[model samples]
Target: MLRDRLLQMLPEDDAAAESVEGLALTVTDLAPGDLGSWLADRAGQELGLDVAGRALQGGGDAWAVAIADESGTSVALDLATIDDADLEALGAWLADPAAPIAVHDAKTASHALHGRGLTLAGVAVDTLLAAYLCHPDQRTYDLGDLTVRYLQRELPTGVDAESDGMLDLGLDGDHSGARTAAARAVAVRELAEPLRTDLASRGATALMAQVELPVLATLVGMERAGIAADVAYVEGLAGEFDAAVERAALGAYEAIGHEVNLGSPKQLQEVLFVELDMPKTRRTKTGWTTDADALADLFARTEHPFLGNLLAHREAIRLRQTVEGLLKSVAPDGRIHTTFQQTVAATGRLSSTDPNLQNIPIRTAEGYRIREGFVVGEGYEGLLTADYSQIEMRIMAHLSRDEGLIDAFRSGEDLHRYVGSRVFHVEPAEVTSAMRAKIKAMSYGLAYGLSAFGLSKQLGISAGEAKGLMDDYFDRFGGVRDYLTGVVDEARGEGWTSTILGRRRYLPDLTSDNRQRREMAERMALNAPIQGSAADVVKVAMIGVTGELERRGLASRLLLQVHDELVLEVAPGEREEVTDLVRTQMGAAAALEVPLDVSVGFGRSWRDAGH
Candidate 1:
């Protein structure tokens, strides 16, 4: 075991000599005693650690530790071969919050450790998150990329070192995995200084410490305690959706007066454009597009039954696929564990993947049934969902400080109805539903930087009408228009827009030479603060709610976070308590011009829990 572990941890002497020719570090395999010695040497100092694990959320297979001291040494420990005593000691050291350490993707590392019956703590810096804070515009924050970008060095590979002082350890297949892991640990160690410095310089240190890191831990808990699934229910829903797909497909074929592959875009195009003699939609390289929007537009113009049936077929197919995905994702423990991605969305919103519960439809009756597939487990009484109503609009009111918008919320009237009355020049009680709908659309659209033409397309109105409506809205709420313009202007000058919590989103393209790119960046700038602030508030609420759950000794646990909503599984007797706790914590998560209205519901399944 020792020999095998050594072979995994260190390269052969000749290979090491040739591989690290220009490198300044020594490589060593950590024997049992070396663990203590290296840790003792680095006590009261910052270090970097990485774990090679079975799965991202599974047990660790090996571990590496690198210190940034002048010694320039990194030690590798194979978890599989390490003595039981050493492993326990390692776990203790890991859980010690006093021991400062940095790692890439600390949540994954924490999950990996958790699978081994260990806990990970003391992660003072998650380089992945720090890099995200530094460069949120980037698509990825891979360790290799971070190492090259921040540390000005490439991670070691099996290839030999370049003569020009770049570090490379000529790792062979026998030891490449372990040696590479060690190299990443070293890179993470070296990255700490520049990354932390960048974060501090950006005034994002508190955002990282107070919001991101704690949310990381909270997410780890939520992912581990995945929501329970009704496997039988999901399987049944899949069948129903499949039937619906077939029925819609048949209906489409009958309407077209012939059978065609509903799944084929070419066939769809032939039927709609050539056979049915419908107007040509947007032209694509392959042909005219048969996408949902184009088809919907065609249907609106001609009221073609074929197009309607085609749209229904597409919807059924989508629902069926989602249900099938849910069925496949059911774990052996009879639950679906979704990975909440923190770094994906630039606005800091948490996204669900691996059978995304967040994407489950809510508005349509068929879509709502899919939520019924997620049920409370045997030990729980039911599911309780609490969500903030009109969170983004509320955020917009707070940020813009528009007196009309602010007063609209404070008046305890329907926001859209009140705004509609003002925009259409009617008394509040006399506002028509149609007028309120337009007001609601315009209000939310402004936050998204929606243009008049885009609003016209969405609401089936003329461009002139849409523009006039927007003019009226701005007239009534000039403060909002001014705030939006100022947000873009300030971002243009400063190269970044800031959230309520001082989280900056850099938009260098605000000064771009290209009109398209600059305008797009302007839209992003306008939306970032409102959307990002909502995300920040939700995160703060998650942290507070999770903390209070423990503080108050509640058995109900948070199952998932879907945008502005939180789903929790209530203990047999704890539904009322959990509801109160969630409402209080979530409503008080952030202070704004308007009260954060929380709607709570309880049900046996997720669908019924909707408020």
Candidate 2:
């Protein structure tokens, strides 16, 4: 029999003892159909058992196991009819420590055998949980995928619930259950040691044990605490957006002297650059200059009514589309469940999936209307948002320890004004708005791999003038320039860069032979430390805030996280306490020379929380 063959495959000492002593098996309903078939096939192929003749009998529950003798002889034993002697014998076999116990279905087995007077433990070590805990980067839970990655062979599918035979062999046609079981068992057995090793090596074993694991338990809680939306506010704003889009569409058609799809970048590129003879700004993968920045520049250069109108048209249509998309994606319970992806970005920032709440437009007035769609939840008094002010710059200053930059922040002087004054060789008060604007552009541009040509295109100045401006800026802030160069050099030397908390980001391309590729890698290397450190600070703050709330038994819940901001759904009368808690936790999450400044706002809607 298959059971006897399995026993014989075990060591003689263990096999002989387990054969004399019967074993108990329990399966879970969530077990896939291929599990039984895969096991049967493996037994037949590897252990020389003919399990095809031992098909299970009539409509068995999703999970079942039979007790048998050492020689694979059937034992007529029922759980309800078994005496203490049988139960003790079965428990002893299970507790033997030598006989390896295999569990097929985890969930069903846990439920069925609970309090059955059998100490068949070990279900607590779940394969799915272990996989997620080990590699949070993977997005799916399919067992077949897990098996294909960890094991070499393909397993079977589906279960045979209706067949009747003594040994309860799986049907050839249904192998999904067998495959799933095998996958789970293999994953469970294989992953345990490696996961522990990785956790220990990363020094995140304690973090995982104390913080991440518990936070997972609270995900459903936060989801259930879904934020209230202003249905009427969203509906009214959506209607207004629709009307505005129509008007913009008409204006765009009027400017072009014909109707065209404003949403189609291809058509726009042809009309603007090819037909209209407008200068091409940049080339996209599809040989187009229809990118947002390029279009804005094209509008500025030509002063073409059509180009300006088209830009406006695109923005309006995009806002309308975003609103419509959000309305459709909202759950039936009126809560938006934006999935938090833990490891998508190379820089280690968390990304939002589904509707992607992180990308909700906020820079322009038209795009800002979408925020009104996120209303205060029922019984919740308001939505409170807090953001780090110039966090990346602060992080850069802290990491570089550039005295000038640190002093600029320490003296409570305006950062852009300081840069403008230094670059223009003027007193801080004499720095004009134009000077400040140029400095502001340069400050942000440097982080994005800006070149003299790119700056000339942006500022509408001669390339010589842009080059001079860059030279002046670097001369005034030599330490900042040197620090930026040093960061890239250090990354190239180490093969990776780490944030304050030891969060590492590999940058293998930093030493690439391709000039463009190497420069791009250098930019990322420079930016990742600043951005990633900020992200690490925020994550720590989130964990700290969650712990504080739970400790105090507060009802407020964290609802969303943007790159540098966090949104909390506040309970009635708890806004003040929650706000204080959040500010304290976030600001102290990291220590920097320039103190981390946090700005807080609250209102019945996201729009209201803007100020």
Candidate 3:
């Protein structure tokens, strides 16, 4: 059909007229009439145009007339402008079930024709989408890469626009229809296998077909459904934070001999470790430890006015900085749309970028003040915060099937007290405050690659004493010890580890040449299963919660996910219902040996949401 159309456009006087691989014709280009005649004359001579539909579609430009032969490639003419009737005709041809049309520069064409209410002749097949389905994590998406890998040759560029912004093919007497047809044929034929292989390899062909691809149709819908933000509330918080920073700076300057850089960890380390001579606890690459825990430890040992004041100063400054960053990052519509990075963490945990929602302040009293900045907008009643309670521990219990651990959660007992009582060889009621405190530290530390030496540094105790405490802990919870060791050993053998959801993370560096790299990889191997599994559970929960909200036609929107917590922006009257929905959906996302528990709270401000 394409060949017939090209042949019909040619001059009747053309001699030695023969179709070479379909549409390419050879006729003397002695004279020309209009654009159409010129194209027809060129088509007969240099333009080895392919009559085959596949060949025509491969050029990536719908209106381009390509000329190619066995020697090499060239373009005869490219139509920069075409009327509606011509476009419609092209579309009609492409829409035929048996006919295929190829177009390059679809993105630009879409934009250019948008104002005229015009669209391409046929539906554009996204090569980028095909490539992504093949390798979801590959970083680049160049057409050149696709062309080389699939077609095994380079396509012509700089044809649509010249340096002088005029239509010029730079023909160089090499333009032929055969070359054009060959290039197009190659692209169309080569694409199918890569697309199929990619879809199969990532286990994402179904996900793409069933979920991700379809969901993109809803992306514009969601953008249009942007959540409201309290502009006044945000601005008020920024003003308050600015005031707090000034006060904290004053306090810090008075505590130290003179004013110093409060934000500089190097300066703080010098003042705390060298000047104060506050028990050289641990050595960092820079010299002495200046981490948050180290600072807290230093404060405890000295009980010095300056150390306490400096710690307070650090907390206040950090809170102020976080608030300031948030204020700066708010979008024009007043809401903060933090970007979720799905693959940054090896364990398949999503990280927040742009404005990091994950690291929002929570623990310290000063940090808690920053929460007050996040308030309900005008049509919204308040914010609802829902968090999983001791989720990681519950997961550990389930995975390890430790009877004592499972019993601890099942009996509705305080986990730290249960652990403390077991470790201290005492009744739960008799577990001292001091014992519970130590157990709390150990519980969290264990998940973070803490060793006896690390624990000793954290607890300000002798390494031997720390080792004894750890041994007692393991003795009281033998299953946990066995589970941790078993996971590490299993991961070491497999060269990778996976979460409960089958999200695999390779750790080839576990056998690295560098000791530090290997040791770090070992920690990751031990930690990935626990952390990653928890991450997977939360992701499934978020997706489920989002779906349920949509199904119920609720007004509440999931605004942010901070590690283990979900922050929801609720409609004025839907707080109670929304809170229940969030807790229920999140808790039911997954089940392990131990039950999932969730805690819910609401407030006009983030601070009020916390108990």
Full-model lDDT, candidate 3: 0.60
The lDDT-based order of candidates, best leading, equals: 1, 2, 3
**Off by more than 4 A, model 2:** 1-175, 178-182, 199-221, 301-303
Higher-TM-score candidate of 1 and 2: 1
Cα RMSD of all models vs. native, in order, equals 4.4, 10.1, 10.3
Better candidate number, 1 or 3, judged by TM-score: 1
Q: In model 2, which range of ten residues has the least summed lDDT?
A: 46-55
Off by over 4 Å in 3: 1-244, 247-260, 265-282, 289-312
TM-score (C-alpha, index-matched) for candidate 3:
0.67
Instruction: Assess candidate 2 and give its lDDT.
Output: 0.63
Residues forming the 10-long window of minimal summed lDDT in candidate 3:
49-58
lDDT per residue as tens, model 1, 1-611: 33344444444564642342122222333445555555666788887876544333232443332333323445545555556666676677788998888887788778767766678777889999999998988979988799789877676655332222122222233444444555667777778889999999999999999999999999998888888889888888888888988898888888877899989999888888888888888889999999999988898899988888889999999999988998888777788889999998988788999868789888888888889988998888999998989999999899999999999999989999999999999999999888888888888999999999999988999999999999999999999999999999999999899999888888999999999999999999999999999999999999999999999998888889998999998998887788889999999999999999999999999988886
Best by TM-score: 1
Query: On TM-score, who's better, 2 or 3?
Result: 2
Pull out the clashing pairs in model 1. Answer: none
How does model 1 fare in lDDT? 0.80
